[model samples]
Target: MSEEEHQHPTSHYVKIWAILLVLLAVSVTGPMLEIQWVTLLTAFGIAGVKAYMVAVKFMHIDQTPRFVTYLVTTTLVFMLLFFAGTAPDVMKDHGTNWEKPAWIAAEAAYAAGEVSHEPEHH
Candidate 1:
């Protein structure tokens, strides 16, 4: 690739940096704003923008081959799928639902006094 194709002006980098910093500030203060959906949306949205900037500017993903772009998109899709599949368990209240076999076993052991409430010494 020519130097011209590979090189970005300092001003471009500065602009992207400034945008990322503003997004970072928004993400940091999002939770304190006391709106759960707004906080989550802002955090995730800003994170996506930051990731896109890093990929396009730092990693040069936008100049990459079409196959490479497809590969990256596929990887991101799979990651979203993995997170979605596990989100229910992560968000669920384990204390209220002891349906898992491990939880049931632990409860049984506690009832039988096989599991001690006190801490063990070395």
Candidate 2:
């Protein structure tokens, strides 16, 4: 086999492992800092980096075909799009303080005791 096809050096893997360990430590200790936004951003940012490392190294996605890489990229893009599309609705307030229409009708009938077993003529 060609030298280019061979796996990366042991030192490279060790370096990646060390970096991942550091990222893990940061993520674990981030919340303890109590900085709120900084902690959350740091944790998520470190997690994304760790995930990318694992995908490239352990999963060997880096050595995969172009199509496989494109597929993964496309999937991530679609996931982001889905989240973005739903975010507005999720964050918006529709002002639904009033009772539901069906529930209101049912409550009115219940209060009037209109729910009888006898048939009602039009």
Top-lDDT candidate index: 1
Runs off by more than 4 Å, candidate 2: 1-4, 9-14, 91-122
lDDT of 1 by residue, 12-75 (tens): 8899889889989999999778698988878888798899999988787877778999999999
- Candidate models: Cα lDDT each: 0.83, 0.80
Model 1: ten consecutive residues of lowest lDDT: 90-99
Query: Residue 87 CA error for candidate 2 (Å)?
Result: 2.2
Cα RMSD for predicted model 1: 7.9
Q: Which candidate number maximizes TM-score?
A: 1
C-alpha RMSD by candidate, in order: 7.9, 13.4
- lDDT score for candidate 2 against the true structure: 0.80
